[model samples]
Target: MKISKQLNKLKNLNVEAEKCSTREEAKKIINKANKAQSKINK
Candidate 1:
């Protein structure tokens, strides 16, 4: 995937994480974002 697209997804994940009420939900989003960031780094 493109870097820009990955970045956008990461940004969205961060927003979702911030809005999430549960710690588990936020952790999941953060994990997803971290994976996306790793993919971008590759």
Candidate 2:
């Protein structure tokens, strides 16, 4: 329950981070999101 809540929070935070208009900002966001997803899968 706690981990799932954290994951959902991460997803919402990532969504907000992804709204940045700069390429650098978006790249960082994508990388962070991928890492989070990988962690979740493991």
Candidate 3:
């Protein structure tokens, strides 16, 4: 259940990243999502 929630959060982050107008902003969001994903994997 927690994992699913985290996945949903990641999905939202992806969406947010897509909406970002700047490459730097998008990169930041993607990096944040990647960190969250790594935590989930562990």
Question: All candidates: CA RMSD in angstroms?
Answer: 0.8, 2.7, 1.7
Candidates in order, TM-scores: namely 0.85, 0.64, 0.75
Model 1 vs. true fold: TM: 0.85
Model 2: per-residue Cα lDDT over 1-42, one tens digit each: 356865986777677785889888888777777766777777
Best by lDDT: 1
Which runs of model 3 end up more than 4 angstroms from their true locations? Answer: none
Q: What is the number of backbone collisions in each predicted candidate, taken in the order shown? A: 0, 0, 0
- If both were scored by lDDT, which would come out higher, candidate 2 or candidate 3? 3
Candidate lDDT scores, in order, read 0.91, 0.74, 0.86
In order of lDDT, best first, we have 1, 3, 2
- Candidate 1 on 1-42: residue-level lDDT in tens? 899999999989978987899989978998899999998999
Residue 40 local lDDT, model 1 = 100
* Per-residue error (Å), model 2, residue 29: 0.1
lDDT of 3 by residue, 5-38 (tens): 7798899998898789998998899898987898
Model 1 ranges with Cα > 4 A deviation: none
List clashing residue pairs in candidate 2: none
After TM-score superposition, the amount by which residue 39's alpha carbon in candidate 2 deviates from its true location, in angstroms, is 0.3
- At residue 32, candidate 3 shows an lDDT of 86
